[model samples]
Target chain A: MVQPEQIKQWIEAGLDGARVTVVGDGHHFEAVIVSPAFDDKSMVQQHQLVYQVLGEKMKEEIHALSMRTLTPEQAAQQGE
Target chain B: MSVQDRIKEQIVSEKIMLYMKGTPQFPQCGFSGKTVQILQACGARFGAVDVLADPEIRQGIKDYSNWPTIPQLYINGEFIGGCDIITELYQKGELQKMVMAAQG
Candidate 1:
């Protein structure tokens, strides 16, 4: 039963210049993360970066997580 | 053979492979169900493995791809991400392109 804020904090703490928003009911979470680290990575790699931040929690604490990873540029582009 | 090797063989055997929670017709999880819908929408002929049915694969797959969730997609032996990424790619029409290219 992990809180969304905790997940957000974990990602923010691990990633540099990351803006993370997570919403969930303790188990299944949906996260939208924008970071400079995602700049040149593929979608799989981008998610992997976030997964690394979550670490072992992904195996036990977080039962499910659906995420949208974006570079700051891509996030801004989505605004248009 | 190691579980990783078995997973590797499975991926290469099918151009499109989905390691999901259940069968496509009876997906056990919402994420897995949604993934099946997206693949069906793309008219993709994919091989599906029910992670829930096999504990070894359920655990092995996560380690195999370093992906922490179910409903993982693989196209032409490449990990394409899970349900969220799959839906995003399908919405962007990239998945259709990949499926078409895979078929040819």
Candidate 2:
């Protein structure tokens, strides 16, 4: 049972200037990550950056992760 | 042909393709089921590959797309994304436009 903060920390550490919010019940997790690094990257590429942060933890600890990744501007414009 | 070659061939042949955990009629994973749902909503004429039935293509796809997950969608030979991205796109109504454009 991984803590939400753990996931958030990993993501924040991975992406510079990233704002990560994570909510989950152990095996399943959902995340909303806003990052400047995501700017100009395709959706696939944005998700790839998140996956890189979790590394083997994604394959091991997390059963499933559903995430919404966005650029800071997109997040702000959406008033999120 | 190698699995990679076959996967590439499949991608090239199908305008809208889904590499999923189970057949669209009976999707094994929630993600795959949801993805198929979106494609159906788009009224997309898509070809689906059940990864569970072909372990070679299943593992090979991860390498092919460099994405770790099933229920991957490819439109016009381009890797769109997995379930979460698809869900988000559907919510924003971008998926409909993309799907329609792919076939148009």
Candidate 3:
């Protein structure tokens, strides 16, 4: 099973200055990610990038995910 | 006829319904909060049931929709999906159109 710490590690590996939170009920998770890497990406692309970080864990361990990807500016604007 | 049955009936009868983690007034999770924001932005006047308050509703929703997630949205008595799907649809302007059509 992919734990929250694993998600944090993945975020730290791919996103140097990202703020990521992974909340889940063991099997399913909701990830809120704010990264400078999202500055020039569409929402789909942003989600794809985060998915890439999870890689095989998404397919093998995690059953479902509710993800919200945002640039730092967008996150700041939403105050989220 | 039980609580789950009533919840299912309510979902089917309501034009726009969200089976979410918390009420719109007090969202318990970030994803549910964002889902509410997206619905509000789409100008949707919908019914929201807090799944977190009732364990039966939370588990029953998955069985009802065959979707193992909270923050599920239903429009016109159809299961649209969970928070991610809702946000994605909202961003593409599809959700607004669907809601408008349903309201008419």
On TM-score, the candidate that comes out on top is 1
**Predictions in order: chain A TM-score:** 0.96, 0.97, 0.87
lDDT of 3 by residue, B9-98 (tens): 889777999988878999988778988999899888899989888888887886776555567788877888667878778887898999
Question: Which residue window of length 10 is worst by lDDT in model 3 chain B?
Answer: B62-71
- lDDT by residue for model 2 over B16-38, one digit each (tens)? 99999989999999999999998
C-alpha lDDT values of all predictions: 0.92, 0.92, 0.80
TM-score of candidate 1 to 2 decimals: 0.95
Best candidate, DockQ: 1
Measured on C-alpha atoms, candidate 3 has an lDDT of 0.80
Please state the error at residue B65 of candidate 3 in Å. Answer: 1.2
| Candidate 1 backbone clash number | 0
Fnat of candidate 2: 0.54
Clashing pairs in 1: none
DockQ of each: 0.88, 0.73, 0.15
Models 1 onward score TM values of 0.95, 0.94, 0.60
The CAPRI class of candidate 1 is high
| Two-chain DockQ for model 3 | 0.15
Sort the predicted structures by DockQ, highest score first.
Answer: 1, 2, 3
